[model samples]
Target chain A: MNLRFQATKARTSSLVLVSPALVLLGLLFFYPILLLFFTTLEGENIGNYAQVVNSGTSMQVFLNTLRIAAIVTVVDLVLAYPLAIYISRLSPAGKAIALFLVLIPLWTSQLVRTYAWMVLLGRQGPINNMLIWLGVIDAPIRLANSEFAVVAGMTHILLPYMLLPIYNSVSKIDNSLFDAARGLGAGAFSTFTRVLVPLSIQGVLAGVSLVLVLSLGVFIMPALLGGGRVPVIALLIEQQAGSFLNWAMAGTLSAILMVIVMITFLIIKFATRMFVRGRIDVAST
Target chain B: MPDLRNTSALKLESIRKTFGRVDALTSINLEVNAGEFLTILGPSGSGKTTLLRLIAGFVTPDSGRLAIFGKDMTMASAGKREIGMVFQHYALFPHLTVLENVMFPLEMRKHSRRDAADKASAALAAVRLDAFGDRYPKQLSGGQQQRVALARAVVFEPKLLLLDEPFSALDRRLRESMQREVKQLQASLNLTTIFITHDQEEALVMSDRIAVIDRGTIQQLGTPNEIYYHPRSITVAQFIGESNILEGTETPEGLRTSSGMLLRRASPSTSGRVLVRPEAIRITREPATGGATNQFKGKIASRTFVGGFTIYQVDVYGGDTLTVRCLADEGSMFEASQEVNLSIREADCRPVPQDAKDAGA
Candidate 1:
């Protein structure tokens, strides 16, 4: 009986210690989400949700958002994996310099970085001028204000997110394992594929999930670089709220985006759990 | 007909390796016969691990010729050298099951999956870990993990095996048992193995022949008995066991210490150190009555009972304080400040030449 009472007293004290942060979160985060939900029901009916779910254009925008996020994720991973591996193999001073370069862009405002990409990809920019000089093209082409421009800008902006996690995971592996693999008759290629890749998979998954989720809800880079040529869910929601002044419709779109984010998170979590469980099963059997 | 049974498994001719400013291994010339278990014994940073890495092809010597089975392998990569290595930390792949870890080398050599699994099972059975083939390395105890490492190393049947202090993490009893198991397994497979360790007792218990290393050089190489009883240098004598080193000059009669104590020993050198093991000196309360060879009268400065033997630091009259060990069942125990007579025969005192350069100074 005394032990149970002691355990209850410990639990009550911990709850009291954490109550301040919990109250702050309730007011700042949860209250706004609750307000957003009630505003979506402004007409005292589910008409706004029904309109978004039934509209072909809104559904097309949703699919476009997923496609763009996927493309961005693939591009980020292809560029990040090898770069992270290279940075991990550098000396201490070299690693510091390399990581500093990777993080320098994050210090600048995202809007400013997007405008920089706009200048590079403009029709009369250096990229097009160089193409003309090399005789690869007769005239400057439409490089900016397209889906390709959005992807390029987003990839440049979000690369460090993909690189840092994988680098951390790869650097934490025991180096003796590589020597052990090589001493056991594995050549360089086999050793890397069998040892390095499987051990650093956790980092790969973390980077991929972070990049994918961030890309899905991105707004500024796509809105500026795409110049109305491309439309993602965030851009559509902004148009509904700012241009049309349709608060209920905007709230409904935001709710849908929030649901998609939650689903994306669940899918990634489920996939990772399944992957780890599968490995455990293979080991046990 | 030439004898085929005497082929050398490995030969290192004048192997010398150096880091940027450090000499890791200097002028190492050694050979191992087929199926021989040779241990490189040294203190830390003594270049024993460097020598093993050189043999395993992880280190390229600055100058030398390394041959395995009479074939030169000086420029070969680690994977092409056909040497199995067990790291001090066991280094079992954390993601791989015990059976899969053993099967890795076989798979790398292009064996079929079924064949690799079968051979891995057999190897696991050899180490008596067949029942644990499904467990990951982290799930096993330290001893079990070491056994898995041993099984994985030998499964591929490499020409030479190198073990880098494989049992330093286990408890004393478990270390002894693992030592016996590894020795038996090596013998049964007839594997030419080179084991490295800093523990002198482990080296003596496990190695067929030991190479005592000091500061990038092999100080002595011989059987355990020769190393224990007849160390040629003062460095080897002091490192291998507890001893009372009496520094003196050799006269026509015997060795005469600076403090006027004469010890009986035949020596070719003008001046050297004589090693008398603590247990070799006979300590008694009565004085010598017969042919007194090298006898001294001393008072016990301190007594330490170490279960098997009682150690006494005896301050001899006008000479060095010598450590003497007496067995527990010696019928009498001397207390502190008790006068005792210590006697040692001439054969028990081995003269060790002073090395030209002190190692690891």
Candidate 2:
């Protein structure tokens, strides 16, 4: 009885300690979201949602957002996994330097980095000048103001998020497992594909979902690097609210994007839980 | 199964390894006979694990020739060498079931799925874990997980087996039982095995021949009885079991102890240390009136009861302390500070050379 009473007392104290943060979250985050939902429903009916979904241009924008996000996520995974593996195997000093290099771009403002990409991919830039000087092309190629440039910029920015989680998972693997696998007659590639990859899948899934979700809502990279060639949901919402002065349409689009992101998060959570439940139980021993 | 034509399972010629400035293995040359159990016994940082890793092909020696079954494997990768190893942590695949873990080697060898499952089941049955095929490794006890590892190691029938302190995590009773199980399994399969551990008792109990190692070198390699009864140097004598070492100089008659006591022995040797096993020293309250050659009058300073035997610390007349082991059921017990007579035969006093370089080499 005394133990239960002390447990309830501790719980109450913890609740009191967290109440201030809860109130701030309620006022700043939840309140704005509630107001946005109400505003979307105020001057709009259910037809607004249908119009946004059925309109060919708006539908193309949503599909383009999904396609760009998927492309960037795949490219990030392919580049980041090998880099994370390399970093995880380095000496302490080398590891520190590698991690610093991966994280340095994250410290810079995204707009600044996107603008830097603009300079690199512009006409008469170093790449085109070098290509023209090498006589590989008759004229300077158009590199900027395209979907490829936007993907390249976003991939460069979001790579560290993918790298760190995979590094964490790979480094946590016991070194002896590799030796044991080899001792059991497994070759180098067999050990990696059969043992190392499966063990680090949790981190791979996490990095993939994080990059995918973040890429879906990317604003600055498409805005600056795409040069009005790329049309995404976030850019469309900005145009609807600021340029067109259509508040209901902007609110409806924002709500749809928010719903897509939430669904992505829920799907990732469900997939991760199902994938790791058995392995985690075995690893705990 | 091991190759029958090759008499030696493994041969190490001048195997030497150095880490930074410290010599991990100074110079090691050993031959493991086919179908024999050899244990490398030592304290921590004694190069026992280093030697095992070298044999398993995980470590490349600085300068040496390693042969398995008369085939030179000095430059071979670990996967190319047909060997099985049980790690100190069991190293079971946490993502796989018990049956899948045992079938891993067979699958790697490109066996059919049905064949792999059948062999895995048979291997698990050998370790008496047949009922736990579907359970994951985390669901098993430490001992059970280790048994699963053992099954996985032997499922593919590697030429040799390496065990690196496989039972150090279990309780005493569990460790003993597992030791017996492994020994029986090894003998039944006639497998050439190399086990490494720091526990002297476990080495003596399980190994056919125990190699006592210290400071990256083998101090003595012999049977358990030879190691316990006849050690080569002071280091081996002190490491293998409890003993009383008396430093003395050789004389024309026998040995003259540093404490000014002249002890008579069968052989007259030079200045060295003598190792007297504690159990060999007979203790009595009355003075000896028999034909015993070596006798000393002492006072019991302390007594420690270790279940079956009582170890008494005796202070001799010349200020040298000696330990005497008496059985617990010896009818009478001597109290502290009681005068006692300790006697030993001349054959029981073995001479050990005092090597100054062997202290921490």
List TM-score (chain A only) for every prediction.
0.91, 0.95
Model 1 TM-score (B-chain only): 0.95
Residue-level lDDT of model 2, residues B1-361, one tens digit each, is 2432367998888889999998999888888898999999999998998998998889999998888888889889887788988999999888789999999999999999999999999999999999999999889999999999999989999999999999999999999999999999999999999999999999999999998888888888999999998788888889988998888788876778899766776655454678889999899878777784688899999999888999999999984899989798657989999999988888888887665355465
User: Where is model 1 more than 4 Å wrong at Cα?
Assistant: A41-56, A86-107, A119-149, A278-285, B1-6, B356-361
Model 1 lDDT per residue over B1-361, tens place: 1222237899888899999899998899888889999999999999998998889888899998888888788889998888888999999988788999999999999999999999999999999999998888888899999999998899999999899999999999999999999999999999999999999999888888999998898999999999999887888888998998888787877888877789987453444578899999999889877684689999999999898999999999898999998887656899899999999888888888777467446
User: Residue-pair clashes per candidate, as listed?
Assistant: 0, 0
Q: Which residue pairs collide in model 2, if any?
A: none
Docking class of 2: medium
RMSD values for the candidates in order, in angstroms, are 3.5, 3.1
- Cα error, residue B83 of model 1, in Å, equals 2.1
Query: In candidate 2, residue B336 scores what lDDT?
Result: 96
CA lDDT, every model vs. true structure:
0.89, 0.89
